[model samples]
Every structure is written in C-alpha cells, then in structure tokens.
Target chain A: MSAVVILTPAIVAGWPTIVAAVAGAASALGLVVKQSVKQDIDIAQQTQATEQTVEVELAKSEVVAQNLAKEKEIVVTKGDIELSVSRDERGRCKVCAKGKGKTKAELKQIAEQFAQKMAQCFVYNRVATELKNKGFQTVNEEVMEDQSIRINVRRWVD
Target chain B: MAQHDVEIVISKTGEVKVHIKGVKGKGCLEYAKWLSKIVGSVREQKLTSEYYEPEVKSKIDLHQQLNDE
Candidate 1:
C-alpha cells in the first residue's frame, strides 16, 4: 500500500442531489416515502398528539442551494415513526423524527441514525461516480458485517 | 503502465478509509487529494513504505518495451 487516508464526509449539494441521496438512504433503511400532501396533513394533526419529536442536524453538512420553497421536504415513514428531512434556514441539513409512543431519546436516536445513513449514501454515490469518471474499474464491492461499504477499484496509469 | 489500486471503505457513519496501492512516491498523494475532494476532509493520513519507492515511469516503459518485443 502506498498510503492510507481516513476522511469524514461533508454533504454539501443542491436539492436534486440531496433528494437522490435521500432516496438511496430511504431505500437502504426500508423506509417508504409518504405523499407530500398526506404527510403534511398527518403531521399537522399529529403534532399535538405526538409527545416526542427530535431534530438532528447533520454534522459538516450544508445545503448550498438557496431559495428553496417552504414545506419542500422529504418525508419518510417506517411503522409509527415519521421522519422529515429538509434544509433549514441556515442551510444546514436537518432530520426531524417523531413517533407517537416513543420517548425523546428514542426519537433522537432514530433521527441520528437516519442522518448517518443519508450521509453514507451521499458519499458512496459521489465517490463511486468520481472513480468511474477517473477511469477506474471496480474490482470488488461489498458491505461489511458492521454495515460499512468497501469498494476496490483498479486502473492502469502511466 | 502500472496498475494502481484503491481500496475504499465507507463506514456506517459516512467516514471513509482509503488505501492506495501500487502507486509509488508522490503519485499516490495525487490520488489521495483527488479522492479527498470527492469525499470530504481528511481526518488522518499515513504514508507507507511503497510511498518512498522510486516512481513507476521506468516500470511502465519496461513493460511497454517487453510487450513490443
């Protein structure tokens, strides 16, 4: 090996790119996307009834695309849990999780987990695409027991 | 040409670990920089013994010549 590097991903992208990553994350976590209108109505009606709501900001992330319209968000559902992912006023990526019978800690954990999954999906897509553009062919790709993704690629360079 | 291999591991939390192989000298640094741009900030990095080896240009030329023969 010539070198080894450890990097922490910073997700900064436009709305479309963010949505792509969100879709990847949702699919990986077995979450279903809820219709926007129905999600809004449900959220409005359930806000008062749900005692636990937690919001988690993704670390080192910025949604650089400006002027995003209000209520433009991705809503996903898994069982009784609802997650809303959006870019806040300060351009930070935020994940809000709410469940009817869950505690604040439980909601917080769910939000944090979702945020991690989203970041992972974003990084994986970006790196794999870039490597392909650089003329590297993937030799092996697998998910480890601990859920980490490992990709090996090779290229003949002069 | 020299075959350059890169092994990338993206952790569950989105942290990336990259191991660049078959690239000697400063050439490996170029790959590291390019990957870092695509991924994010480098939390830590280490250069191995291969990084101190001679450049791969001579090896590439030798292989080309052998193929031509």
Candidate 2:
C-alpha cells in the first residue's frame, strides 16, 4: 500500500440526488415507502397518542440546487416506526422518526441510524460513479459485519 | 502498463478509509488527492513505506510510450 486516507463525507447535493440516496437507504434498511396520505395518517395517529418524535440533522451539509416544493418530504415506514427525510429551510437534511409506544431514546436511535445509512448510501453512490468515470473497475465489493461497505477497484495506468 | 489498486471502506457513520496500493512514489499521492476531492474533507492521511520506494522506470517509459502513440 502506498497511502491511507481517512475522510468524513459531506452530504452536499441536489434534492434529486438526496432522494436517490434516501431510496437506497430505505431499501437497505428494509423500509417501505409510504404514500403521502398514509404518511400523514401515520404521523397523525402517532401524534395523537404519547408517541415520541426525534429529529437528527446531517452535520455541515446542505441539499441545495433543486427547488424543493413546500411540504415536500419522503416518508418511509418499517413496522410501527415512521421516518421522514426532508430538507429544512436552511437546506440541511433532517431525519425525523416517530413511533407509537416507543421512548424518545428509541426514536432518537432510529433516526440516527437512518441518517447514517442515508449518508453511507450517498457516499457509496457518488464515489462509485466517479471511480467508474475515471476508468476504474470494481474488483470486489462487500459489506462487513459492522455494516461498513468495502470496495476494491483497479485500473491500468499506462 | 502499471496496475493501480484502491481499497475504500465506508463506515456506517459515513466516514471513509481509503488505501491506495500498487502505486509508488508521487503517483500514489495523486490518487489520494483525487479521492479526497471526490469523497470529502480529509480528516487524516498517512504515507507508508511503499510510497518511498523507487518507481519502476519501465512503467514510466511504458506510460510515455502510450502517450506518444
């Protein structure tokens, strides 16, 4: 090996790209996308009771460029839990988790997990696309036990 | 021709660990720089012993020949 680099990914992309990552994240986490009405009903039913809601925001990041309409958000459901991924007025990505009969800590954990998954998916997609564009071919790809993604790629440089 | 290999590990928290292999000397730095630009801000970087090893002259010559062609 010649060098090792440690980097922290910044999720700064347009709304479309952010949505793509959200979709990928949802798929990876086995969450199903719910329609707008279903999402509203789920959130309403949860709010009616003593359900907890937790919001986690991406750090030092912004989803800029695309003009996202007001009240536009992507909602996914996994069992009784509902996760809403949206961009706030400041253009920062936010993940809100709400579930009935769940504690604040539980909701917070869920939200944080979803946020991390989304960020990972975003980085993977961006990096893989860029690598392929630069003429690199994937040699191997796998997910580790810790949920981290490992990708090995090679290119012939002449 | 020289084969350049890169191993990228993206943690669950979105932190990236990149290991560049089969590239010696300054060429490896170029790959590191390129990856940093694509990924995000670099938190840390380290150069290994292979980075200090002399580059293969034939590889450079082959690259030059390819460019000339």
Candidate 3:
C-alpha cells in the first residue's frame, strides 16, 4: 500500500485511441464486431421497438494521427442492434447504437454500457504504460472485490 | 517485485468497471490516462491512500512509458 487518490477525469485522447476504446467497449458489452461502420441492425418489436441515439463530442480533445494498431475505426452489430465508432471531423470519437424492436430506454442502456466499457479500456491501457515507464515492477494483477483492477508494483526510490 | 493487478468486468449491460490498485503517486494518473484512451473519456476516478506515496522510477523514459496514454 502506497498512496491513493481519486482523480478528476480529463479527456485528452484523439480519434484513433477512441476507436480502440470503442472496440474494447463493444467487446465488453457482448456486441460482435461485424464490420467497419456497416452494421446489420435487426431490432425486434417485442422489446418495445423504440430507437434512440446518443452522441457525445469531446471538448478538450487533440486528435493524434499516429498509426497505432488500435487506431482503426471499429463497427459492431448483433441482431437488429447496430453500433458505429468513428472519429468526428474534430477528431473526437463518437459512438452510436440503434435497435428497432427495442424500447428507447433499452437502447439507451446499451449505449451507456458501450460508453463505460470504452472508458475502462482506455484507462487501463494508459495506466499500464505509465507504470512501466515509472519503473514499477508488476508483482500481481487481478480483478478485485469491487469490480476494479488491482495491480501491484514496486520500485526503489533511494 | 510489486503486483500490478487490473480487474476489468463488464456488467450485464456491458458497462465496464475498473479498479486499479497496488501502485502510488502521480504514476497512477498515467494508468488512468492510458485507459481513458483505450476505453473512452473517464467518467469517474477515485485515488485511494496508495496514490499519495512516492513513485519508484526505473530506467525507462517517462515519454516511452506515457506514450500509451
């Protein structure tokens, strides 16, 4: 046990990274990666059949054009549910999900799920990179009691 | 050697919850930044008592370590 502090999240990633995050988020949500920006949405009416769309524009984003393996845009769709993740003109990543047979509330839940997973993947990658740079040796890693990740690292400062 | 543990769970609806433990200081922020890049924008972050400790620096350049962010 060393020090712990909860931080105020600052959004500073470009579109490419956001695309990766979208893929991660999609995978977490059990959405299959069908194609890039082209999904087959087959919403069913039994689930209330209402469609909703949510788009969040990153305000303090600086898009980096570097070619990273995770930079490609990822599109996922399952059944009538469809999702597309891409960089906006301003380079902020955007996520959209639509289902025809599901209620608006259901679709909203799916969208929010995607958003959270995306955030989680992004944070996990960023933290790992920094720890390695700081020379913290990883002793153990695992899923913890509260659905969070516990990473053990040690380094000698003296 | 310290243990770096990351627990990633997707809820029934695909919402993800991440808990990072065992590291300290500003170094934790780097992890947070990297994950935000991988996942999406961060919605919330809580630094426990471990984050206040001093960082243990090895030979790796900060740039190389933080580039993932």
Candidate 1 lDDT, tens digit per residue, B1-69?
Answer: 789999999999999999999999999999999989998898999999999998844534444345554
True contacts kept of 1: 0.97
The best candidate by DockQ is 1
Regions more than 4 Å wrong, model 2: A36-50, A69-71, B55-69
Question: Model 3, which residues run further than 4 Å from truth?
Answer: A37-62, A65-73, B1-69
Write one digit per residue (lDDT tens) for candidate 1, span A1-158. Answer: 79999998999888778888888889999999875443574557565663578999999988875676244688888998988888788888899898889999999999999999999999999999899999999999999999999999999977
Tens digit of per-residue lDDT, candidate 2, span A1-158: 79999998989987778888889999999999875433575567655677677899988668886375235578889999989888788888899898888989999999999999999999999999999999999999999999999999999988
Angstrom error of the Cα, residue B26, model 3: value is: 11
DockQ per model, Cα? 0.78, 0.71, 0.13
Candidate 1 yields a Cα-based lDDT of 0.88
* TM-score attained by chain A of model 3: 0.71
Kindly report the docking quality category of candidate 3: incorrect
What is the per-residue lDDT of model 3 for residues B32-51, given as tens digits with 9 covering 90 to 100?
A: 67655544566667777878
Better of 1 and 2 by TM-score: 1
